[model samples]
Target: MSTTIEYVRFESTDPTELAAHRDGLVSLLRERYGADFLGAHLARSEDGSFLDFLLWTSPEAAARAAREMPGDPGAAGFFGLIGEVHDMRHAEVLHSTQV
Candidate 1:
């Protein structure tokens, strides 16, 4: 099985706005990324920055999702207002006891 993980960092002048935009972004991802394989997390960092973890079922699925990300759709600068970096990693499952 393939596994992918991303650590995303987002910061914005307005945390509430960022949270709202993030909700929209997640919705878009859920629609395009396929079923039974998409997951995400959002947390407030010690520095008050937002940390996001997005997990997918496979590396290929992650890449495909990346390529298929929805267009701005008038949501310009959404991420810039909330996040800066999206750190990502891809790997294969060598072993696993739980899903």
Candidate 2:
């Protein structure tokens, strides 16, 4: 069984600094997650409210990665954007026949 994990996060203040930080961070994720990664980036307005989605190889791995996100200067200010960071939701697909 393959597990797919998804997450939705909201930011109150969309500072350009935050945008720059996340942009760099996502690029790093590509290198790390690779083939198991699925990217969905959304920006609703200029004020900086946005949502990002990701699909991971396994729900467990996703959860772990989120917790242990690479600590870098760009990541340092990430949590400041939101008053709360919700836990990522996930599901298991026994058979995903793509046809």
- What's each prediction's TM-score? 0.67, 0.60
* lDDT of each candidate versus the true structure: 0.66, 0.60
What are the per-residue Cα lDDT tens digits for candidate 1 across 14-89?
7777677877778777776657356778788888777777778877787675555534563444555754554544
Clashing pairs in 1: 10-83, 11-82
**Least well predicted 10-residue stretch by lDDT in candidate 1:** 68-77
Consecutive 10-residue window with the lowest summed lDDT within model 2:
79-88
Question: Model 2 over residues 1-99: C-alpha lDDT tens digits?
Answer: 366646665664555666667766677677766766665454544544555566677777676667666354455666455544433456665655547
Q: Model 2, which residues run further than 4 Å from truth?
A: 1-3, 43-49, 70-74, 92-99
TM-score of 1: 0.67
Candidate that would win on lDDT = 1
